[model samples]
Target: MGKEHVIHTDGACRNNGRDNPQGAIGVHSERGSISERLPASMERHTNNMAEHAAINRGLKSAPYDNNPVVIKTDSELCQKTFGGGWAQQWERNGGRTAGGSKPANYDFVQDTMKEVNYRRSQGQDVRFEHVRGHAGDSGNQRAHDLAQQGLGQGAPQYKYGGRY
Candidate 1:
């Protein structure tokens, strides 16, 4: 088996749900890292949305190769929504929850599914693992710090450029 390529992603939303809420994504990989704030006019600036964007962008920008891609995140929702096969079931169920309710964050979930499937079809193994937030793990810490930058809390510690 080839070596794994690890991608640690995180999102932060300052004043979420309030007017002028801000969000951002932080991506850390062996190649490099990225810290990006959400667009100025985003309709929703929730933490979950920011998390979804980080994971999606990480997958989208990951290098296409034989190595497996492990996406480390603190959001269990993202892990369960995609990795738990709920997304697949939701698609088959016409995007309804088991209770017949419209699923939340449908767009982000759908977009993530597309990116994951496309990567799989390209021979990349993608996996999502939930990491505890604020843990001292180096990668997770770096990602969290970058996320803070996304929220305009501080400057990014690393230059942003790489395989993502």
Candidate 2:
């Protein structure tokens, strides 16, 4: 086992067919500074998609060790889906709707959940923690800002390092 850590991720989709989309990931030591890790883009997408990508990227950035992780995010949907373990059901069904149809955001949700659970199985204590946005949470704020910036016509850094 090793020391635990904290990670915060955020994403944004500026507009569809009119604006670009972006995702950002921020990581912090349980005891110190935060790291901003993610790439922003100007591609068409939805906020949900960006948010999911942020969580996925954050999970991937975490080290695979027997250490606990506190994954922070501003997306309530993302938090609940991962924390409640319901994301598994969505994945097991191949991102399909219960009515034998297709869900709008089922694919990414299922894929991301699979990755999150996989990380957990690899000894990484990847726990989802919900955080309020624009309420003086430095890490969350930075991630949000980065996500917005990522919706530009350029590439942004996916990882950032600093104290929250």
Candidate 3:
């Protein structure tokens, strides 16, 4: 196994859970960083969506090599969903929760899963670590700041190469 690559991701939203919520996702790693508004195509804009989107983008940005990649995020949902088998179980259950209702941010969850499955197919070990938000972790702080900055920017033009 090669040295692990750590990428910190975060999300931010303005006026979340209200009318016309705007959200953004951020990704930061030793290689580079990304900050951009959530795509307009997303049906609803919420902080959770932004959080999942950040993990999706972060996974997409990971190198296509054999090195183990660790995704650090403040969102425990993201960590558990992708790293703790929630997605797999949800998928096995036809993308529905145990209550027979669709999970929130289901599309984003699938997108992240696709990236993770692809990376694993390529012999990459993907992991997720939960880092408490705004707790003075430099990488998480940088990702948070980037997501905040993304709120002011327009939608991203460059594609990170994913199905969704």
User: Top model by lDDT, which number?
Assistant: 3
On the 0 to 100 scale, the lDDT of residue 147 in model 1 is 84
TM-scores for every candidate against the unseen true structure: 0.88, 0.72, 0.93
Cα lDDT computed for each candidate against the true fold: 0.82, 0.63, 0.86
lDDT per residue (tens digit) for residues 30-104 in model 1: 989889888766667888988888888787777888899999999999888887889999999999988998787
Models ranked on TM-score: 3, 1, 2
Q: Please state every model's RMSD to the true fold in angstroms.
A: 3.8, 5.3, 1.9
Cα RMSD for predicted model 3: 1.9
Question: What order do you get sorting by lDDT, best first?
Answer: 3, 1, 2
Model 3 CA deviation exceeding 4 Å by range: 154-164
- Model 2 vs. true fold: TM: 0.72
What lDDT does model 2 reach? 0.63
lDDT of 3 by residue, 1-164 (tens): 99888999998889998988888888999889998887666767889988988888887887888999999999998888888888999999999988888999888788778888888898999999999998999999999999988888565732434543
Clashing pairs in 1: none
In TM-score terms, which candidate is top?
A: 3
Q: Local error of candidate 1 at 26, Å?
A: 0.5
Model 3 misses residue 28 by how many Å? Answer: 0.4
